[model samples]
Target: MIADAATRAVAADLERQSAHWVAAATTFLDAEEFASEAAWRSVETFVGLPLRRHLKVIVEELIDIGRATIALTRAARRDALALPEAMAAVQKLRRRYTQVETTLDFFGDAVSSRTSPQLRAALQALDALAGASIAPVLTRAGLAPIPVLTYVDKGMGASILRADIRLWAPGSINPVAAIKIVRHNLYRPTSLFHEAGHQVAAVTGWVPSLQESLGRSLAGDAELRAMWLPWASEIAADVFAFAHTGYASVTALFDVVGDARTLLRWPIGDPHPVGWLRTLLGCAMCRAAFGAGPWDDLEAAVVTGFPLRRADPTVRALLERSRSRMPGIAVACLTAPVPGLGGSPIGAAVDPARVSPAALAELDRTAGAALWTSPHWRRTEGIRIVALAGLREAEQPDKASAWIARAREWMTATPLAA
Candidate 1:
């Protein structure tokens, strides 16, 4: 009779703790940030319809977890055997809590940084670019409502993540695409295009399609397929970037890596090809897009550090072969019609010829002085476009700093349309 009393007391304490947590979770869910009408409308207006739905799904999942916790506690009380079984169920609930917490933490970080005007303006610019430029391309590729959010990070390296993977819920509504970038390196955020290309592959199943294409193309050559298969995604991304930015992407990539010493020693089986080869692929795409001229000069400059005379024979032979085929393969991947998109390639739908070099240069030259005066320029140029061109002319630190200031001013004043 004493032992039975002890078990009941323990069960009561367990129920109390679970109840407290349920209240806490409910309070969090009810906070104005997620639950307020203003918050929902603002998110829908600025973030998009897709993301509003995504946020609702996340909130529902979190609330459901809380309700499940309460239900589990009641079940424990009703069943006498629950004391032993309770630990396993509690452990499972704890894991679910952890998953929800991680997602919220990431969202919190993005929200916190928006308090800075410069950061907020930058994010708005990215969103504007997404709606105006990137979204249409993705929609043509047949993956509508792929919402992208831009956030600042400590690392110099820019990164992208599919929120579906982050949340461990595949095929979730309004799937999130996160682009984390270095705050100061605003000039070459063409990495945004590269990362978006990664998303395109993920969302549209382009990577598998490319893999199958490669398998068919190289059917008899198993060794070549093994080497090429691992590098396919990276190649696709590079091609995609090249398609958008043209030669500007090539120069931006070189600036990001800074030197060619890293390229000389790259071996087979790596995820990325040698840096020189990457630049060469970009050069090839540029040539294909805009007929051959000066690209040969650019390619020669890219290989200056590891000249053919000094290359390891294996590296040299691999380059000689990839030089001929990789370009064609990349161009085909970019230009080939996406299956359901009315016989249009995602690249053609993007019509990146619109990103003109002369216009961008003019926009950079007139930046702070005349940008707001001319409504035509204001409507056309985006942060990534003008920044890339601005950095070309304002390579000096002081000049770049001034340009960034102007960019902030331009971005802050321009309101994104609802």
Candidate 2:
């Protein structure tokens, strides 16, 4: 009789715990906990129907897990196995509940960012830029581009949580490429292309191919090959950005990674190239594509500021050897044909020459003042205008404020896709 009474108590406890988690999962199923209806409407307006449906699908899946947990609890009770079996079932449900909460929190932050009008507009524009930067390469490579979501966060560098990857929820796949753009660099966001490059590299297998190519290209120097092989992913992304945005991407990269003290501070197994080497590689890319430009001056400035004497003897030797080979590395990145790109070089898909100093100047001269004000041009060529603005800001620091204002205006004006 005592054992029977204990079984009844365990069944009741399972029932109560199941009810609590079901309610918890259901709370975010409608997203009301994360945003008000008006705010949600604003998100819907900017993110479009497909992304909204994806979010809904994720939520519904969470709720369905809750339902299944409840069914398991009831079945345990019916089988009179409440003490051990039902208790284990409820514990498993708790673990799943935690995962569901984590998934909601990850997406909820994105949804919450859309509530504020200023941020909403900025993110919407970033979404367009991200799409513009990545679509041509993906389409040319015969892969479909996924939806992109941009949100502002406090950081020096931007990052991406790529779509279709497994999420915290056991069976759930991320439905969008969520790119976090740093607040300070929103107006001159060449980093967006870098993060998008990561997504492109992942989907198209550019990184592994580039890694193999780098191995072959640097085979003559065992040390150089070993050092560069590890940096293929980052180098691939940098190549992607430089291919699409030219010197603007290079200059923006300099802005982010140019501190002299940290220039040679490479941690073991870090995917990023040593900062000084990375910036020089950017200059090499410009030299290769456009020939004799501001990047040469920039490279001189970086080399002068961060001399090899400051580095440790071992590091200095590596830097000295790598300096002469930077141009070759850039060429390898640009000219190599990748299987992911269907035997086409990255440069062929998104040509750097299109955004060269001369080309950007020509675009500006042809568009005149209408480049900033025309709705049609802003919609179609907004990404190139951003590159132009970055170039102008780098070339004419005195007029940076005006260039930034114009870039911000168009970015806010551009519409998100439906």
Candidate 3:
């Protein structure tokens, strides 16, 4: 009789613990958390519906687990055999609670950052640009473009969390492709397309194919082939950005990765290419697509700034061999047919010629002042305007401030298509 009384007390405690967690989990995030209506509206305009639905489903699942756990505790009080099952259920509930907490915290931080109206509008513009960058390729590859949510954060370069991946919460896939655009580069965000390229490559299976093509291209040298294969994902993303934005992508890349100190320092197992070679590879893409232009000047500056003598001898040899094959590597990235693209080269989806230096200049000449002002033009040609802005920043450094302001104006003015 005493043992029976002890068992009941334990069961009651377990039920109370589960009930407490259930109450805590019920505090779901909503627009009420924001300070102003405008803040909530801006966040709602971009990521509200999908994120809310996703969170609701997660909370419901968590609540169901908690209730089931409470039932298990009640069963434990009746039969000793039920005690172990009840304990297991409580453990499972705890695991689930932790997972749900992590998932909610991640999204809560991302959504809350958009409370500022200006930051929200800039991110919205980036969302539109990301769509413009990846839609053609994804559509051509017969894959639907996922919802893209861009947020500004501190960093020198941007990063991405793809939509197709599984999330922290069990049985949940990430609902949106979240791209982090660095704080400083909002006005000249070619890196935005690079992050979007990661999403495109993931959905289309471009990186694996490009790696194979690159391996074949460098078949003559075993060391060189091994060295380049690991960097294929980053290279494919660079190719994607270059395909959509031309020399503008190259120039923007220079600004981010052009530090002379770590230019040739290849960290063990790092996926990114050495900074010097990466800049040159971007220039190589420009040369392959547009004959010769400002990229050559930029390339000359890189070579002069980071002389081969600065690199260790083995690294220098590898760099020399890689330099010779950059043109072929660039060509392989652009022209290699992939099954995801229905056997069409990635270049076919977004022609480099469309955003070539000459093409961007022609667009500027044709559209004249109206390109920056007209809603129709802003909506239709906003991507090109982005390319042109990067081009101006690269070629005409003196006018970068004006271009930055112009970019901000259009970006805030234009909203992503519903």
Q: Could you tally the backbone clashes for each prediction? A: 0, 0, 0
Look at candidate 3 and give me any clashing residue pairs. none
Candidate 2 lDDT for residue 187: 85
Report the CA-based lDDT of candidate 2 relative to the real structure: 0.80
Q: Each model's RMSD to truth, in Å?
A: 4.6, 2.2, 2.2
- lDDT per residue for candidate 3 within 1-418, as digits (tens), equals 1228888888888888888888877765443432244544565344567866887899889998899999988888887678878888888888898898888777666655675667877777787778778888888877775778787788789999888798898998888888888877887788888888888888888888888888888888999988998998898889888887788888888788877778887887999999888999899888888998999999999898888899988799999888988898777777766668887878888888989989999999999999887877767777888899889878888988888888888777746453
Supply the global lDDT for candidate 3.
Answer: 0.81
Q: Give the better candidate number (1 or 2) by lDDT.
A: 2
Candidate 3 segments whose C-alpha is farther than 4 A from its true place: 1-3, 29-40, 43-47, 416-418
Q: Could you tell me the lDDT of residue 69 within candidate 3?
A: 93
Q: Could you give candidate 1's per-residue lDDT for residues 121-196 as a string of tens digits?
A: 6565665554454566666765556667766677645677764564633224335677776665554466677777
Q: Report how far off residue 154 is in candidate 3 (Å).
A: 0.7
Model 2 TM-score is 0.93
